[model samples]
Target: MTADTDATDAGAAATDVTEPGATPTATDTTVTPATSAHPGPDAAAPAARSGRRRRVGGGLAVVPLLAFVALAFGIPALAMLDGAFTVKDPVTGASSYGVANVTASVQGAYLTALIGSVKLSAFSAAIGVVCGLLLAQAVVTSRSRVLREAVLTASGVLANFGGVPLAFAFVATLGNSGFLTRRLDLTDKGWSLYSFSGLTLAYLYFLIPLMVLTITPALEGLRTQWREAARNNGATNAQYWRHVALPVLAPSLLGGFVLLFGSAFAAYATAAAMVGSSIPLVTLQIADALAGNVLVGQENVALALSLDMVLVAGLVMAVYLPLQRRSARWLA
Candidate 1:
């Protein structure tokens, strides 16, 4: 019996060892609970691929707008630049490249037209600044929200309200046979609608509104505390404006003026409609040059004038951008 018990014990020990080292079945080969619960590389790879796809989709969305701008604004600008230096041969009708057209554009009647545009822009912008500042200040100082909202809304609309329609409105209001003109009979007083003075007067319609839109925020930025502090320091209202307000608002005011100057300088349709060929504006001269009315085959001169206008506008922006940043520092 002792021998038999030893044999059975030995058999049990052998069975235990074999069971612990047994091969897995088909069920064990399939994913276990822990293995299924924790995903592996294949599972995470799809997530990474989806994230990449989202980024690529976002990039593709901007392509249409970029293409549009390249075709619309970029292509036109390049064409104008190329045409500016190109001179067409009168004999062969072939195009040759030279800066002679540019030189010609900068002298003679074209020069006069450029100067006129500058003077008109300067005069209009100056008047608009002063008048618009007053209007903006008045609007800001008002107690009524209705007044402020109404003024701002009107200003926004009027600021963008230039072109042939604006010209027509001014004509109906102040032309020789117009309502106000007929009522006032301003022609007897040396008033003429088809003149530079009349064009400047019409330009003020939109210019003042533009100034108001630009300057209203700056005027509002003039804190009540500053005025109160000035008054408490025994400074009069006039003194406050001269010392405190003027200095504080100078950058914004000047920036607004520069913006207005550029607006007036680039204006073509309104000036064209109002003055026609009577006044010699650079824009009008350009139209004439392009239409082959003044010296045929001088289309390059038109492009040169356009280049000059672009340069002027560029210079204005260069000055205005720095002043604008400075103004934001104070307002912020």
Candidate 2:
């Protein structure tokens, strides 16, 4: 009786340890191997852990992108946009704010500047595109790799050489009493550093490089076969360009010019330093309003000027929109 009781307790212990997924033991006589049904609790655990890991990895990926956009673009935009609404007073300690600040005189000044800005920007971009395309064409076709490398490097350096230092360089080189003018003694050649010609010349220094950089990819996208096919069919250079290359290059040319125009339009530092009140840019006019006589409702006029700049920028962007869509495949 004692031996039988010990065997029964041992069997009960085995039943408790053996989960539903466990196979019947060789010594068991009742339960069958083919009749096992349920999965053990441990079976689903690895799958759940894998899913958790995937979620964690995905979340980690977005952190850097959000941080980058916020750090670079988000902060500065808020500052500029806020300035358009705030009203400052000279006599009073505090200032008022609202979009009701736009005035007629300011609006007219804005419209005038807008016109000049558009004209100059368009001129720069047109020149830049034509010159840039030719330069790109020359660079890509050259057999001399050394020349290509040197030209590309030089273009990059010159393109970045703008703002205050660039202004200084121009003053030193082309100013009435400057070295180049003295060296060439071209004072009698009828050139003026304070003139539109000078500004356009300086602008091209940066613009050409931008054009070269931007249009190189487009030029490269043109296959040798396209030219060969055209030539095989007796297509003249003008004919080929008219029928094929111009269509492809049109979007890029237009887009690049529009961007150049916008850059020239709001350019304050270069124009202010170079021309001052001697040549009244729209930007310089607006800047003058904020410097002194801040009271007596001039704040509204300044705000109006600011809005004009915004509208000008918007028009440039509107032109950019369709060009982007047109160049989507090749430009992409």
Candidate 3:
């Protein structure tokens, strides 16, 4: 009877240890291969389908932008490229593909205009970069919030204040019978409003502000810890800037210079209104060719010039984009 009672107690203990719905302990908490692999086909298929749907939705969202770019830029670029390589036959009055226009565009008068344009762009961009950098640095170091806001607001306004209106404003202020020209008698000092020097002066009005806006953000990205570290190492102001600040700022500066150069190179309305045929800018030559002022039915020459401008601008942007990326790595 004692042995039978002991067996009954042992059977109850075993039942308790193997309880059907009991909570798992630490040792039993590990994941099994079946549980780790997947939640079964039903759960996985829905999740995969949802992910694919999201990717498709995202791609669909950008379709309009892609279409707009294709129509606006890609088609026009292709048309110009085709025109650049095409010529009209004088005897047959039929268009044929050739490189005569391209050759004409790169030699003699057209070549001179191209070289002049490059020189003007280089000069204006150099000056703009220097002045703009100084202004941006000054704005960055200022303590007054109102002053900083005011400078930035003014810069935003000035940077975009270009085109024919800019030309008109400069004319009103500095034309022979105009405000400052009359007050200061600049004409007597050999100043001409239609000269290349005059055009560069007008360009600087907008270019400096553009530089200020671009470089200000770059200046702000500079880490204060860098200056502090430099000082801790007994570096002077000049030494700090040369060794720490400038090296970091170089990419931004170079990128801004390239942007300015391209801006000056592609400028049309201001140069057209102010100087016209007086200055042999590539833009003016293009306009003349287009209007049949130079060569009628030979608009291919104009397209060739356009293609050259595009190539130059493309090169500048190519340089700028890499520099901008380098600057971002540091700034970020």
Clashes of each: 0, 0, 0
Cα lDDT tens digits for candidate 2, 1-332: 99999999998887757567778676544665684476556877888889999999999999899889988867755655565666666678576675545545345555566566667667777788789889988999999999889988898898777877877888888989889999898789998888877877778878888888777777778777878999999999998899978887778777777766766776777767776666646677677777644335564466567667778788777877887688767545
Q: How does candidate 2 fare on TM-score?
A: 0.72
Name the Cα RMSD for model 1.
8.8
Question: Which residue pairs show collisions in model 3?
Answer: none
lDDT value for model 1: 0.89
- lDDT per residue (tens digit) for residues 1-332 in model 1: 99999999998776555355778665446574655676789999999999999999999999999999999999989989899999888889898888988898899999999989999999999999999999999999999999999999999999999999999998998897889888998889998888888899888989999999999888888888998999999999999999989987988888888988988998999988888878889999999999999788788899999999899888877877776777677788
- lDDT accuracy of residue 232 in candidate 1: 99
TM-score, prediction 3: 0.88
TM-scores, each model vs. reference: 0.79, 0.72, 0.88
lDDT minimum window of 10 residues, candidate 2? 292-301
Q: What are the candidates' C-alpha RMSDs?
A: 8.8, 9.3, 4.1
- lDDT tens digits by residue: candidate 3, 1-332: 99999999998777557457888677557676755565888889999999999999999999999999999999999999999999989889998899999999998888888988999999999999999999989988999989999999999999999999999999999877779999999999999888989999999999999999989988999999999999999999999999989988999999889888988998999999988878888988898889998768768999999999988888877877877777778898
Best-matching candidate per TM-score: 3
